[model samples]
Target chain A: MDMRRLVGGNFARLRQAKGLTQEDVEARSGFSQQYISGLERGQRNPTIITLYELAQALGVSHVELITPQNDET
Target chain B: MDMRRLVGGNFARLRQAKGLTQEDVEARSGFSQQYISGLERGQRNPTIITLYELAQALGVSHVELITPQNDET
Candidate 1:
């Protein structure tokens, strides 16, 4: 239920799944690579606007970033 | 690509879809109603942990919250 930790974990997983680097997201989303890194590390608190941009950059819905996968059936 | 605007829009849509009031999410997610309102209004910059918690309370994956629905498609 920790948003930061969950987002960081999910972000890392999704980014890796898509074979994307932080730099790529930064370039696509116009967010700084350092900011993305901070987000992945749970060190940054992003506004909703930032999250939407990140989702767009990732080619996914904004919900995908906040939603938890049903890994446990 | 504005994260806050996207999140706020999506949040409001989802909440309306489920007939959920901000208080309902607040009770379920342990986040304050005011906070949820602010988030929906794109007024709050939540940490990843907070986002994750909100997702749980909403009974969806974290990704769902961050991901944008393909309404056009």
Candidate 2:
């Protein structure tokens, strides 16, 4: 299981759960919607700080972004 | 609570629990001992891949490094 995909999937799931669009995350985290799209597509190599900011935007722990889900991929 | 310190503490605690030194992590993760030392001091802002690799070296889940422990910091 690739970590990028794992993170991407988690991000998408969390964002959807909160009823947030990419633009919502963009406004909250100051990361562009384009970047958010790239991240959700598993195309970004984010630093820990990026992970931290995203977690902040989503109102969850940073660890949640990187944790593997119950569904095996 | 600083995430860097949290990660550093977790890394240090886990490594010590396993009786492994920075040298041992270097051998397993191909990261320099000096870098490991810096990371242990919370001086390094590691990337996601770095976190993943270090977890591999430590034989723990990557989330463990970033997760806050029971101790108050």
Error of 2 at A62 (Å): 1.0
In candidate 1, how many Å is residue A19 off? 1.0
lDDT of 2 by residue, A1-73 (tens): 5777888889999999999999999988788999999899998878787788889989988888998888933
Q: What TM-score would every model get versus the actual structure?
A: 0.57, 0.93
Off by over 4 Å in 2: none
User: How many pairs of residues collide in each model?
Assistant: 38, 0
Model 1 Cα lDDT, one tens digit per residue, A1-73: 5566556667878898999999988877788899888888977666565666677788876666666566622
lDDT of 1 by residue, B1-73 (tens): 5566556677778788889999888877778899888888888676565666677777765556666567622
As a whole number from 0 to 100, the lDDT of residue B4 in candidate 2 is 73
| lDDT of each candidate versus the true structure | 0.72, 0.86
lDDT tens per residue, model 2, B1-73: 5767778888999999999999998988788899999889989878787788888889998988888877833
DockQ of 1: 0.50
What TM-score does the first chain of candidate 1 have?
0.83
> What's model 2's lDDT at A57?
89
